[model samples]
Target: MANKTYSFYPGCSSQNKASSSNYLVSTNSMCQKLGITLNEVPDWNCCGASIGYGGGGELPRIVLSARNLALSEQHNAGQDMVATCAACWLASREAKERLDHSPQMKADANEALKEAGLEYKGQAQARHMVEVLIEDIGYDALKAGVKKPLQGVKFAGYVGCQTNRPFGIAGESFENPLYLDNLVEAMGGEAVKSYDQKVTCCGGALAFSEPEKSQKQIKDIIESAYDHGADMIVTPCPLCQANVEIYQGEVNKRYGTKFNIPVTYYSQLITVAYGGTAAEAGLNGHVVAPAKLAEIAGK
Candidate 1:
């Protein structure tokens, strides 16, 4: 019933039961209540993510994202392409910007797309989910829509890397974004403003290449939230959620510390606070249980 129905690009994380499934699930559930609908782009491929950044091939990375743009333009025309994955948002936006900046580059990307019978004219806009929520749906409206305020629970709004660098949300400070904090306060939770690791990297896929170094970064990310009295960390990025949630226990063991902090998708919190269930929030996928969030929603 929402007037704003965005074309969704699920990216690699939420596909085939991957670690980010919970993010996608909670997103769909929350959007329904918010009067926003997401329509998935058919036959979408990887957004290249950090892997694309490592390739050092300009057109190839742009082309990977272009293919999705082209397909969405073809199928879901006139829509703003909304992505829950931060990497996908960055990749798609970069691809569009590169093409828009140069007609030759756009032509070249289209030529590469010819093999698949698709061509991107850059019709659809690339946007992260949080951008749409905060910009299109203001805090006043969001606060008014909340059925149950998340009281007593403290939260750290982690902004991670992809959505921060090059292009942050329209009106946020890149160095210290407060959209998440604003959202938490809108939902009646105490946002930890002093949590300084807001823009720190979570080691991404590097966790596999260098476990100790990655654990150290994850340690900083997790511990900073706890140090600030945050019961949980909420983010708009699936990669952040996966990296931080899946690694805290390992980091705690390595440093001989006790840390159990839940990294959650903002959509999950919205869904729960909007009178949706714990199951609807997709809390099951979290390695560190967001039981505090579930308990808050119960009231």
Candidate 2:
């Protein structure tokens, strides 16, 4: 296979949360096998996420997003900027959309970016890892590489807010989305159907920034999944994994329910399905380890 290079953006979440290291390395490994080379944007700053937009206003958002895009453009590796973090993916996407829609805003952002010796030309395309893997790589290719398959394990597909929200601009249909479910099926797992809240927010940003409502939403979703009899919840975003895993105990205590389901990344599941073990996929570190996932997958 030829080397297919893509500009990689490891958002602030992965950089800070050491646990995400496994996911990142695993993704890189998968990409290598699939002939996809990840060229990380160098010296990348925060995408502003929740903070860059409101507190410092939209300028910060534009500046940060432009900076990352400019770095990728400089490399000229590929037009696609592969984003790993959910928040960064959302922020970069929002910045790109707003700047492209408003010429004046684009010019202003570029002018500000002059200080960093960068400019936002709106050429680089933003994409979630899940999107690139499923659409670009194709399910047949992935299935062929599977040294193992998840036959018995049933997974609850959890696509958090940023991945599928804001409706049209995101280029994904929020209501009838099937990429995540498709990924699960490709891995040979039973992509179990859950309630509507399956696509809801993980309450991560809100939990940290706005506690009351965040907890309520998070608790409701967890409890609802439990009620629906899901063996585990699978998500693409690391933020979703962090929020649900860390808060499951608190949610259980508050709601008087067992939110003991494991939360694993889509990549991690693929790794396992491809005959990789829990330690290899970082499943051991998960709050609720899918001990039975391997057996279910016939590994």
For residues 210-235, could you state the per-residue lDDT of candidate 1 as single tens digits? 88988888889888898889989999
Residue 53, model 1: lDDT of 66
* TM-scores for the candidates: 0.97, 0.90
Q: Give the TM-score of candidate 1.
A: 0.97
Output the lDDT of residue 275, model 1: 90
Top candidate on lDDT is 1
Off by over 4 Å in 1: none
Model 2: per-residue Cα lDDT over 1-299, one tens digit each: 43667889987656534846656755765676567878888998888875565677767767788888888878754469988777778878888888899998899988888988887777898887877887677778888777677776777787887777763223457775777777888888877776456777766667887766777888877776677767778887777878877787877777787677888788777777776656666665666777777454444
- Candidate 2 residues lying further than 4 Å off, grouped into runs, are 1-3, 16-19, 167-172, 294-298
